[model samples]
Target: MVSIFLRSLVYNVLFYVLLVLWMLMAIPTFLLPRRVFMRVAKAWARSSIWLMSAICNIKVEYRGVEKIPNGPLIVASKHQSMWETFALLQFFDAPLFIYKRELGWIPFFGWYLMKSRMIGVDRDGGMRSLMEMARRAPKEIRGGRQLIIFPEGTRTPVDATPNYMTGVGQIYASAGVPCIPVALNSGLFWPRRTFMRYPGTLVVEFLDPLPPGLARKDFIVRIKASIEDATKRLVDAARAEQAQLFGRVPAKT
Candidate 1:
């Protein structure tokens, strides 16, 4: 336990240091095209993944990447940990994220988010905010950008009850694009609300895409079922692996 705690401490410190360095290096991208800045961002994501593996012994496997379609699409992924936010960027050409408006108020980090043209919504704005998101999503989709959103809208602990929001379905119906459901067991290794990073395989599987034009109700049901079922399988598998590594499954907080 002490060894794990020390490793987690080192990993956390290095992760932030690396982030600051990358941010400084990417400053010039602010003047370049959006794609150019996106390349920088992807590189950073890759670096972070590699660092976690090197220092924390966490191996990452991305399955069914070939299943991801080209052109405008919606990537609805399970929200487990903060890992997916940037790790998933490497797979898309033009990836867009819907984030809290307050995050856009941060210093350099927020500035880059604005430069990338990510959608920011006021959580306090109620239905009006959702309507605005629904209206703006299709335009971006038409521009050939992949909108990556978490159906649950926030990260949930491993084995927690699924609480998918209806807003993703609204955006999907309006965007008129196939939605790829992604399932990952990231919370097992990178549990939220804590600094500990565990050693184990972190798997992200891209399930089959739900075709465009389904009724909003049906779309929501299908996406939720697909993501939750696949996520359960992943979490179970990772728990077994953790047990083998540590003589017991670590309790997820």
Candidate 2:
């Protein structure tokens, strides 16, 4: 336990230091094309993944990447830890994220987010904000960008009940593009609201894409079922591995 604690401390410190270095190095891309900045962002994601494996003994496996289609689409992923927020960027040509508007107020990070033209919405705006996102999303989709959205809207614990929002369905219905459901067990290794990083396999599987033109109600139901079921399998598998590693699975907070 003490060894794990020390490793987690070192990983966290290096993670932020690496982020600051990447942000500073990426500054020149602010004036360049969006794709230029995107390339840098993807590099950061790869570097972070490598760092996790090197220092924390967390191996990452991405399955069904060949299933990702070209052109505009929606990538609806399970929300667990902060890992996927940036790690998933490497797979898409032009990735777009809808984030809290307040994050866009940060110094360098916010400036880069604005430069990349990510969608920012006010959390307090309620239905109006959803409507605004619905209105703007299709335009970006039409421009051939892949929108990555978390159906749950926020991270949940590995064993928590699933609470998927209808916002992703709205975007799917509005964008008129196929939606890819991604399932992963990231929370097992990178648990939220804590500094301890566990050692295990982190799997992100991109399941089959749901075709466009389904009713919003049906779309929501299908997406929720697909992500939750796959996520359960992933979490269970990781828990077994953790048991083997430590003689018992870690307790959920």
Candidate 3:
């Protein structure tokens, strides 16, 4: 526990300093010729992962990396830890994210996010805001960039049955493109709002895409089932791996 605190403190300092520097020069990096911003951004994220590994000893064991694409795809990911955001940024180039509006107010990180043109949905307002998100999302997908949406909406329960939201279904219906359901167990080590990152592997599983034959409303159950099923599989995998690594004797594989 003492080691975790020390490591977290050191990583926080390094990350904050890097974030400040990243924000100050982000615009030019993003606007420069040849669209080399993605190159710089990927390098930055790779370094972030390296720093986290060195400081916290948190090893990420991701799978299905080949499924990531350059074309417009709706990435329906299981929501758990916030760690995947950095992984996504590093792996994919400027893929638009659908997060709450309030998160945009976060200090240096939010500034860089805004300048990068990531999308934020207002979760507090009434139905109008919801409609706007549903409305705007399809257009973004149509524009050739992929999207990363947490099917559970917000983060899921740390140790309870998982339930996915209907918005992901609605988006799949409207977007009319292949939506990949990805299952991740990032929360196992990097629990939400917690500074202590346990040394373990984080698994990201890319499940099969939604049925291309189905229409919008058909996705209501189809997509939900897909995400929930995959989430369990991924979570189970992470739990098993964590048990073996830490000598905790897991429940089941």
TM accuracy, model 3? 0.84
Going through the candidates in the order shown, the clash numbers are: 0, 0, 0
- For model 2, residues 128-203, the per-residue Cα lDDT tens digits are 9989988888889879999999989899988888888888877888889999999999998898999999999999
Worst 10 residues of 3 by lDDT: 244-253
Q: After superposition, how far is residue 19 of candidate 1 from its true place, in Å?
A: 0.8
* lDDT minimum window of 10 residues, candidate 1: 133-142
| Candidate 1, residue 127: lDDT | 86
Tell me, what's the RMSD of every candidate? 0.7, 0.8, 3.2
Off by over 4 Å in 2: none
lDDT of 3 by residue, 1-253 (tens): 5776788888878976775675666657645642366566666777777888888887766677776655778887777776777677665554778878888998756655676667787888778888888888878787776788877777765555667677776777777778777777777766777666776667777777775447656765666677667767767776777778767733321
Best by lDDT: 1
Per-residue alpha-carbon lDDT of model 1 for 119-183, expressed as tens digits? 99999999899899889888898799999999998999998889999889889888898999999
lDDT of 3 at 26: 63
